[model samples]
Target: MVNNSRTNPSSDTISYLELLQEILNKKNNLLGFAGVGLVLGLLIVFTTPKEYQSSSFILLEPEGNVNSFGQMGTLAGLAGINISQLPTSQMALTSDIFPDVIHSRDFLIEISKEEFEFESKSGQIQTLGDYYFKQRPGNIVKKTINYIISIPGIVSGWFAKSDPLPSILAKSDEDQSDYLKLTSQELIAIGELKKRILLEQKGKLVHLNVEMPEPLIAAKVNTMVLERLIDYVTAYKVGRQQRNVEFIEQRVKETEQKFNEAQMRLASFRDSNQGLISQSARTREEQLQFEFN
Candidate 1:
């Protein structure tokens, strides 16, 4: 009975070994796939394009009434007007108007046509069509295979496919526009050029640091953005001031008209009553003179 048990165990062990050998034999078929995968990965890494970087910095300064108002709290409080309610500090550093100005469609449209030229060799031109069109032919092939494989199954919906190149390019361009739109929409977008932007605020000081893929563009954008911001702020302030001036001028004109009418009425009253009191006094003086004669 012991020998019978031992014989049965030996047969089971042989069956397990045979299964292990079959798996090893199948692994040989996968070796070719693994080699191809490695080569494709290396090609992708080596051929991928690289981007350059550039940057600029801006230091925020207090402007207009905010600056005066802050000083008034410290030095002009004894002059009978309390300016403590005004938020000079907050106003100076406020970013409330920046996002709108930066992201305005007009502003984005202005920079959209700025040139972004890259060099290409004659040899590169020959391969450009193949790189853009044919290199990813497997994408279409895989989609077609998936569609065919699905037949009438539940996965048929997932396998719906179109020509890969046009769809891929369209998607890529759309993504690029989306990215540009985000930047064009806000002054803070300058900081989104990868990790090239830095915002620093210390005490009353605010600094905006922007980095780009080109040096001149970095400087240009930094300068232009700040200048535009200042211009917008100044124009807004001037517009407010002009409106106030108009209101004040209108009030002054109304007050002047009322004053002139009151003055004319008083003068007419004096003119009409001028002789009555004077005539009475003159008659009394004549009677006193006759008595003296």
Candidate 2:
């Protein structure tokens, strides 16, 4: 048998290069591909929605100390109480906790329920919640990519088994709670809110930013959310002070009762004794008289 094992490495390399060159020689095909790419790029640029951000900076100060309540402070001291520490040493709210408050289910639910006149990308004015839940526009590219990526997960979930009994019991228990439990619509609103709103704290300052496709709506939402947060913090401070006021009032009532009883007893003693007096009793009586005077 004749051996024919020798192959030219240079010839194989040249052939591959010739094939690539032939493909490049087809200018019509190359131009068509380029044109398609250009059109897609332009479509993406034009079709993608525009976002407007409206932001505000806030300087958060600690709630004033209870000691600042001039006359109330004095009265508290006289009553042998520290009015300065009546409620708390400082405001309950801080920049660190502000984000948590804003993200809380109750707060988000309140925000979702609020009605704002928002003009959508399509120039139709509607309630903010409605816009978020029912009419929000989608990005074609993003939706397509997400759907493609989630194909595997969707298949797996379809095959997975679920236990109806425990799920039903847990859902019923959740429904019975007074705390804010998000419905499907409310949950969608929350997801949109999270994407649109940003919060950050620096030193003693808090910066809030809200974004939307509509400039007017963006600004309105930003202002409204900030106002809500302020109101929540103020209400907490007022509530603490109210409890302090109630405490002081109760103590005052007790002190008055004791004073009234002592006065009545002294008056009765003087009535029964008439003109009777001894040095020690006389001195005591004079002291009582001085106090009454």
Candidate 3:
């Protein structure tokens, strides 16, 4: 009779057993890989610098008007003025704009010059940007990683025939200016500052968080950011009022000059026609006086 079985069950079972045995034989190699992975994970955990994070919660409400000017509203309208637009107006910067203000290049650059009391290094006061760079290279592993990353750049720099750029010095608070242009180093520092600082708003409250190597410095920076934000918003609110006041003052000066000119013309007309008197002229003079007054 022809064979009914296509394959031998005994041979197939033996082959499956042999496969499992091969895997078991290489068990030491698998264990070695797992051991190396465990060591690498531990190295990363211990070698990484510890970050001190501090968060500040700010509750923002609508900017209220001190004087509603309800009583003066009618008079102000008659004089072609709006009392609501005086002294203080609605904030031009809404909550949405706050993030832009916080992340602004100029804002970051200006804040970078601010001094902070770093408790890590014997309570030394250092510029924010300088302190950030100082905190780097905390461990040997990180230093080695940084060195490795810069190897290519260093090698290329050696072969380049260009003159070396002078190192950028950190600017003191007094040395900083509103119109100051950033150098390459300053730009890099500003970039790092942006990364360290984070702003988030949940519901009606805003959370400003800053991460640093020192808790004291982180807290100080958080407070400083809050203060600066308040100051900036205040300035923005008052700045518009100041500009409007200046424009009004200029208009008042012009009006006063015109009034003086009219007075001068009336005096000259009276002087020239001293003796001339008529009922119609008297009426006309009365009308002119009323208009000038």
Candidate 4:
């Protein structure tokens, strides 16, 4: 026997019409809450600082014949083909290392020191270090986020023993390599910059994106990074070629010295034994000729 009942307490639930009517009754409360949310959103939007972004393509494509590398990704569209893995006749520095080059400590430090006329609410010329370190001037939202994120570090700092970072200049390392001792200002500036600058490889094109709180700074930094990247790569290529040339020149000089020595020995033997017909002299001439050749 099957038992069917309309009143099942286990599965009791309201219908769609009942739910709609209940929502309608509370519409005034919902509207009030929405109004408050709208006001808060508008306040945050208007008060919060705006970040401007500027982008430029990196010039790393190969030219003429070999233009299909990872950097020169013109021919990488082929299905499941990795050019870097393939054995090629050309050995070159590709765009892969560019990210590392730009993010290098020296490169970042240099960029931090570059003075620019920063325009936010007020206009003033200062280095990137001064602007960010002195006045990262964080908003309420940023402050809350930073506080949350830094809780662990703050707790650790209490237990740990370390010197406070100096405002002007601080040692980067204990053992002293004279390698990029950063100021507290630069430390903050670099931290900010790391977030703002990005290198992305998209198919055949490599691009640089820079973001700043100000419009002009964004554009300026984008241009600066591009110029510096090109310069660094050019210098590396030129230096490699120069070393190769120097090696070849040194080899040529040594060969010339050997040739001259052989010639002199041959000439001296001929001068001393002129017209002296003997197997020893003839054998000696043959030996000298072999050596000279």
| TM-score, structure 2 vs. true | 0.66
lDDT of 2 by residue, 1-293 (tens): 89788899999999999998998799789899999988877877777778899999999776676655667666666667877556475556666888888887777777777666555445655655667787444565665776799799999999999866687788988688776556877777887887888899877779999988689888988998899998988888778777777788788777667667768767876887777777777777776666544
Give lDDT: candidate 2, residue 137.
Answer: 46
**Per-candidate clashes, comma-separated:** 3, 0, 0, 0
Cα lDDT, model 2, residue 151: 100
Against the hidden reference, what TM-scores do the models get?
0.42, 0.66, 0.65, 0.67
Question: lDDT tens digits, residues 1-293, model 1?
Answer: 35543358888889999999998998877888899888777765665444333333445555655333344344333333344443333434265445555656555444433443323322232221123222322343454665687677756657977555787788887788645444322332322331343445555554555554345455655666567667877777666545544544555566566656666655565566566678765565455444333
Tens-digit lDDT string for candidate 4 (128-219)? 87777876755656667788998998899889987787754455445467656777677777788888889998877898999888888899
Per-model CA lDDT versus the true structure? 0.51, 0.77, 0.75, 0.75
Q: On a 0 to 100 scale, what is the lDDT of residue 219 in model 1? A: 65
Per-residue error (Å), model 3, residue 120: 3.4
How close is each model in CA RMSD to the real structure?
15.8, 8.8, 7.2, 9.5
Better of 2 and 4 by lDDT: 2
lDDT of 3: 0.75
